[model samples]
Target: MSGQIKYQWRITKYNPDYRDENGYYTLKEEWTCPSEIGKIIDGKEFTLEEYLDIEAKYIDTLIAFIIESGLNTLRILQLSEQKISTEDRSSVLYETEFDELILEEDKIVTLNDIVIISKMILRNFVHCQLYLKDRFFAHFGWDYYMYIGSSEKSLSAITIATERGLFVEEIDSSPYYFLEEDTTRLVQWSKKENELGMNEGDEELLEFPLEELRLIFNLSSQHPVVGNIKIKIEYKDFFQRYLNHKMDFDKYEYFFWGGY
Candidate 1:
């Protein structure tokens, strides 16, 4: 009593209009679980208990692949536009089950630990799937980025823009320069009194002297809207600091948002 099973987890969000008196939208989360007959995996039909075991094994295998492949860092992107906010390496570890292992100086955290924590963060915090390089790519940080020592040198962390119908290109300097034009981009700017009794604002992009990492965005004249802009960051320097505890969750949030 077994055949090939096509299984998937689905989440459906209702429109805002479909809200309850409490102003909550209807969200449906669904998945199929075999209640009677066994499900076929590979060439073998497996009972519920056996299927669960294989499912866990498959997940573990994927985790092992990520760790063994040296995928130590994760790029945190905004869900709506996939704007690369910042890189994450340690914060998830501190928040997840690996906290004590991470906090203890005597204990050494491994690549496996980092990957598992990152996966958990993406699932629980971001509510996003933990996608591999081939599955998910990013295209909004810097102009050009490559991992010096990895075989999968693709800019997976900065390819979302192109996939989402935006072209990416390189410019002379940091994209933070746009902060000058976009008032909201800056946390604050100085307003000076002008000769005409008007207030002239003196604005500058926020500076992070220790930051070798730069946020890169490609803005096309054709599509001038912020939604069309794709962004990413040079994460190597930031990741190094994160590993050494030189950067923490609070600092990461500040840097990600460019201040409060």
Candidate 2:
């Protein structure tokens, strides 16, 4: 009998200090697609439209699962923030114990539940994003950590991996900036090439909205073996069209990839 195939959409969070002898750490929450569905084509390049077709077909289902199962935990955090804001207006000192707050059936929630939900949302988002954008994936033992805080408060939230860290970065900016570097570079290059006749420094790189960044991060982190993947497309007409129409094609040709 043949072994059953398995596929997974996975995203991971790593302990910053969890390094091996070579300075590589284990990535937590690695998701994979079910083997039955098979892997994406290894080296083929798809047009932006072609990739979006795949995402439109499959991403919603995955996103629905994550939103339904994982969003509640995040909601709990939102609720906490709301409560804090309300208390600030009344000048009430916040005194609830962390354990006690979490235990209250109506107020407190489990970190375990939040972690599970976060992982689910992240995996689904990654799968969907990869399907829509061209991307290059690479892997090494190194990871990045970021601390997110509101300018109004001393408290901060930290994200320990590239995907989550980038998501946090995009919370205040646009998502388009987070697309595959090739797309961004191409867009910038195209812009520069067109503005060559203008005074130096007259052109700026195109900017994307914050939501797009969140979407991209959510989508890129879904795979376990990302290093072998990349989406490279030839933009034969991009330069000519940019000059002729003064329109940007960079927004359309996004790509991404990942690895263990």
lDDT of 2 by residue, 58-80 (tens): 33332332233223222221111
Each candidate's number of clashing pairs is 13, 41
Q: How do the predictions measure up, each by TM-score?
A: 0.25, 0.19
State how far residue 36 of model 1 sits from its true place (Å): 20
For candidate 2, give the lDDT.
0.26
Segments of candidate 2 deviating more than 4 angstroms = 1-13, 20-23, 26-120, 126-149, 152-260
lDDT of 1: 0.29
Q: Cα deviation in Å at residue 259, candidate 2?
A: 22
Residue 253, model 2: lDDT of 29
Cα lDDT tens digits for candidate 1, 16-134: 34558894444432122323225554445646554344334333433433444456443322233222223423322223343333321112234554444333432232222222222
Model 1 residue 10 CA deviation in Å: 15
TM-score, candidate number 2: 0.19
- Choose the strongest candidate by TM-score: 1
